[model samples]
Target: MATIKDVARAAGVSTATVSRVLNDHPSVTAESRERVLAAVERLAYHPNAAARTLRSADVTTLGLVIGDVLNPFFTELARAVEDEARAHGYYVITGNADEDPRRQDEYLDILLEQRVAGLLLCPTDRVSPLVEEVVRRGRPIVLIDRSIDGLDLPVVRSDNATATRELVDHLVALGHRRIAIISGPTSLVTGRERLAAFRAALAAHGLEVADRDVRIGDFQTASGVAAMGELMERPDPPTAVFAADNLMALGALRWVRDRGLRPGSDIGLASFDDLPWFEFVDPPITAVRQQTEEMGRAAVRELIALLNGRPARSRTLPCQLVIRGSCGERQGAQ
Candidate 1:
C-alpha cells in the first residue's frame, strides 16, 4: 500500500498539499490536484476513508440525495453538483432516495454520520425534520430543483407554475379546447406545483379539467403510455395532450404511433422537459423548456456561496414555451 508520503513525493508536491487535496480544501488548484490524484493512482494508494475521517475528524465530502436517478433531469442535476463540488476540492457522495421521505431521512442520517461538510437535496415528503436536523447540526446545505415550505434554507428551482401556465396558454391560443395532462407523483413539490399550474391555466380559459382527462403517474414511460391510453378513452377525447416529463412524453408518442396516428400531424402534443431525442422524432415536439443546465449551475453557485458565509435565499429561473409543429392546431376544424 502506497502512503501519502509516496504520493506526495511522486507528485513533486509537499505532503501538506496532498493532504489538502485529499481533505478537499477549496484552495487546491485543479492542475496540482489532478497531478496528486494521478500519483496516488500510479502508486495504487487508496486512502482509507474511515481512517482519514477518524484521524482528521472531518469528512471533507459533500452529499447529493436525489429523488430519481433514472430521470435524466435528476441525473443532470447531480452531475452538475458533483462537478462543482469536485472543482471546489470536495468529493461528492450521491444516491437516489426513491422519493420517499423516509428513505430521504435515512440517507440524510447516514450522510450526517459520515460528517459530510454539506448536502444538496431534492427532498421527498414534508422533510421538515430532516431540514431541522441538518440546521441544528449546523451543516452547510442547499436545496435543489424544489423547495420545502416553512424551511429557511436556500433553494434553486425553475418557475414551474408560470412555465406550465404558458404552455397551456399557448395551446389555447392555437385553438385547443380540450387539452389533457399527464403528470408525475403529486406528492412531490414539482409535480404538485406543475399540476396546480396546469389546472389554473385550463380554468383561465374557462375549460373544465375533466377528471378523465387528467392522470397521475411516476414520471416513467409506462405511466405516460397508460395516461394517454386513458385520455383516449374519454367520451370526448382531448384535442391536445401535455405530458409533464420527457419519459412520459416518449411513452405518449409511442402510443400515438401504435394507433396509426401521426404526432404533431394527427394528434397534437405538447410537453414539459425537452429530451435530446425529441428533435429526431417525426415533427419535433413543442415543449416548455425548463432551464435545466442553468438551474444546475445556479444551484452550484448558490451552494458555494452558502459555503462561503453568504446569507441564504431562494431563486426560481424562468421557463419558455417553444413553438413547434407538435402543438400547431388543426386547420379547418369545427
Candidate 2:
C-alpha cells in the first residue's frame, strides 16, 4: 500500500508538506500542491479513513507511546498515565518504542490508524514526521518525559538540570574529586541536559571534566555495565560514578559487585532516577527522585486541555535528591 510517507518521498517533500497539500491548507504553495497531487496520483495513495474520522468523532481514547517498557521509570510512568486517564473517563492504548526511532514511528502510525483522539509520546532522540503532521492537523499531541528540538509541543518532565546539579554537589561534598558519569544517549533532551548539568556542576567546584570521564550509554542496563567496566579499567579510575538513569545504575551496581568492590567503601555510586528498590539495595543508592506520577497526570491534563480546544502549556516538575548510603559521608568534622 502507498502510505503518506511514500507520497512524500515521491513528491520530494516532508510528510507535513504532503499533508498540507492534500488538505488544501492555505499556506501550501500552488507549485508544491501540484507536485504533491501528482505524486499522490502516481503512487495511487489513499489517506487512511480512520485518520479523517479522528477529527470528526469524540474519541475518549488516547495513544501513549513510551521509549522503553522494560525500564522501571517508564513502567511507573505508564501506570500513572493509565490511572489518570481512567479517572478522566478515558482509556489509553500504549505502545513501547524500546528506544528505537523506527519502532517509535511505527507505533505512531498504528495509534493514528486506530483513531486515537490524542497522543502522549515519550519520543526517541529524533522527531517523527507523522507526529509533526498530527500537530499541523491541530490534533492534540503531548510530550512525556522527553522533548524534541524545533517542536513547540506541550511537554511534562522533570527539572533535570537542577537535580543533576544537586547530585553532583552531594558527590563532591563526599570528597570525591575523580568523578565519572554514565550518561544516556545525547539525542534525548533528558540525556543532553543531565550531562551538561553534570559538567557545569563539576566546573563550579573547580573540577575539570576529562573526556575519558564521560561514557555514553543507551539508557539500558547492559550499556551501563559496559560503560562502568570501561571507566573502572582506566589507569586513574574515578572514585565516584554517576549513572543517568535507574536501569543503568542497576548495571553499574552489578558491575561493582562482580568485581568484589563495595559501593560506598571502595567507590561511590549515585543515579538520576530513584526507584523503590534503590533503598533496599545492600548499600542504598543515592538518587534523584522525579515525580513520575505527577509527570504522567500532568501530561494527560495538558492533552485533555488541547482536546477541549484550550491552550496547553508545557510543565517542568521538580525532582528531589534522596541521600543514601551508596555515597558515604566524608570524614567527620561535625
User: Per the 3 Å backbone cut-off, how many clashing residue pairs does candidate 2 have?
Assistant: 0
Any idea how many clashes model 1 has?
0
Writing each residue's lDDT as its tens digit, candidate 1 over 25-57 gives: 899999999999999889998886777888775
Candidate 2 TM-score over all chains jointly: 0.82
Clashing pairs in 1: none
Best by lDDT: 2
Question: Which 10 consecutive positions of candidate 2 have the poorest summed lDDT?
Answer: 325-334
Reference-based lDDT, residue 287, model 2? 91
C-alpha RMSD between model 1 and the true structure: 5.4
Local accuracy by lDDT, each model? 0.82, 0.91
